[model samples]
Target: MIEEIQEQVAYYNARSQEYDEWFYRIGRYDRGLELNQCWFNEVDVLKSALQDIGEVNSILELACGTGIWTQELLKIGKEITALDASSEMIAINRKKLNDTKIVSYHQVDLFSWQPSKQYDLVFFSFWLSHVPPTQVDDFLAKVYRAVRPSGRVFIIDSCFEPSSTAKDHFFENENEIHQRRKLNNGQEYQIFKIYYQPNVLIDKLTQVGFQASVKQTNNYFIYAEGKKINKL
Candidate 1:
């Protein structure tokens, strides 16, 4: 399991330079202008939902890739700590954010990294699906500890939409735990990718002592917002 997780980190590190291309709909990820418009539209939907959560004085973002959502969090959070396993990803993130004083970057493996302190919110984007099924409960427990009482947790992750990937890749069986991903250079890596249902995830979060609600974007993403109800 550790080896697999390390490979996942390596893949992200190697792909960091091209990561934003996927989000920007450029180069290999260009699906078409129409689909790209839909993508940003759904992204706006998620953004609006995050804004609706109201202001947070402090936020900790786990696996914050290249600061895409980190930039959004800055709008609502006075102070943000963004952590990822790959230093390369953090480098790009820092460059993108232009050394913002309001945000701190930490490069640490999420599986072994523990929070040094609690915050008003603990958030992660497109990261939960990368957690192996065996570690989901433990991971949420870590999130619970990182958030203050009455504080919130927000997560955004990919849905099983076939159009969400590059044109060259095909959607795999939903039940599969590992998926093969390729870089623009055609190098391949295996990573953990799980498609979680909103309701089922809500139940799991509830069992972990959260008052949670989850919603799906029209077709592309699943997002959840939960408030801590009790200590784990």
Candidate 2:
């Protein structure tokens, strides 16, 4: 499993350049632009999840590829620790931000990287999908330990439950993508799958001792919220 995960990370790291080009080649500068727009459209849903958070003093964003939320957190005056498993992505983030004081970028595996201090808020945007369901319990426990009492956790992900639209989009056919990649050594590769469901993720979070809930809309990705319970 570890090897599989590492392989995925290394594959992504190797594609940062091509991925960057692909993102803009078709006039979609941000691959997540649609997702971000959907998020803003449903910002109220996110705000409700974060209502208890009075002031976000310190934040940790896991799998913060290219500082998407990093910019938003900085705009709100929160100190951020942005981390990702891909060094190439981190390099892109660093170059984009120019090593600003408010943003600290780290290249580390989320599962093994231990936090030096607890944070006021912990967020994972479009990250849980990359994690296989079996390891979710351990990941949640780590996240619960990383937040202070009353701290909140936010996650934005996709639903595994099939939708009519998604079915037509990708599920309706298996040969949705036919593009192939050939490495310099002549090895060939193709993307398999890159999506997940909300219920599976929420159940895993609850099993790990969190109070989790989900919010869904046509405009955005599935939104899940959990709060760390204070020990009595």
Candidate 3:
């Protein structure tokens, strides 16, 4: 599993340059203007949801790839600690933020990294699904430790939507945790990809000592917000 996680990091490092193309609906990820509109609409729903949580004094973002959510965090957070396994991704993120001083970037494998400090808010987007099933509890525990008392967590991820991928990609099986992903250059990598049902995830978070609520958009995304209610 560690080897698989390392490979996943390498894949993201290699994919960093073209990562925004998927988010911006360009090149291979352009499904159509209609689908693109739906994507952004769902993204807006997520943004609004995040805003509803009120302001955060400090935020810690895990797997802050390409700074998509990092940019959003800056609007509401006074300071942010962004962490990712790929230095290339952090480099692109730093470039996009124009070298913001308020945000500090750390390149470390999340599986082995421990938080030396806590924050009022913890955010991770499209990242939880990448966690292997065997490590979900440990990962959530790490997230729990990263949050200060009375702090909250917000997470966004995919919802098993077929249209969520590039036009050339296909979901080979419905019941698998490992998925094959391809880059525009015809490079391929196997990465952990697990789609969780909202209720199941809510229960899991609750079991891990979070007061959690998970909801889905009209399509394309599922988001959850939870407050730390007690120590795990």
Model 1 misplaced regions, further than 4 Å:
none
Candidate 2 residue lDDT tens string, 30-95? 335564454456655654545544568888889988765566566543688888988888888777
Candidate 2's TM-score: 0.72
| Model 1 / residue 137 / CA error / Å | 0.6
Model 2, residue 115: distance off in Å is 3.1
Clashing pairs in 3: none
Alpha-carbon local distance difference test for all models:
0.91, 0.64, 0.90
Model 3: per-residue Cα lDDT over 11-93, one tens digit each: 99999999999888888889888999999999999999998887788999999999999999998999999999988999999
Q: Weakest 10 consecutive residues, lDDT, candidate 3?
A: 166-175
TM-score of 1: 0.97
Model 2 misses residue 137 by how many Å? 0.8
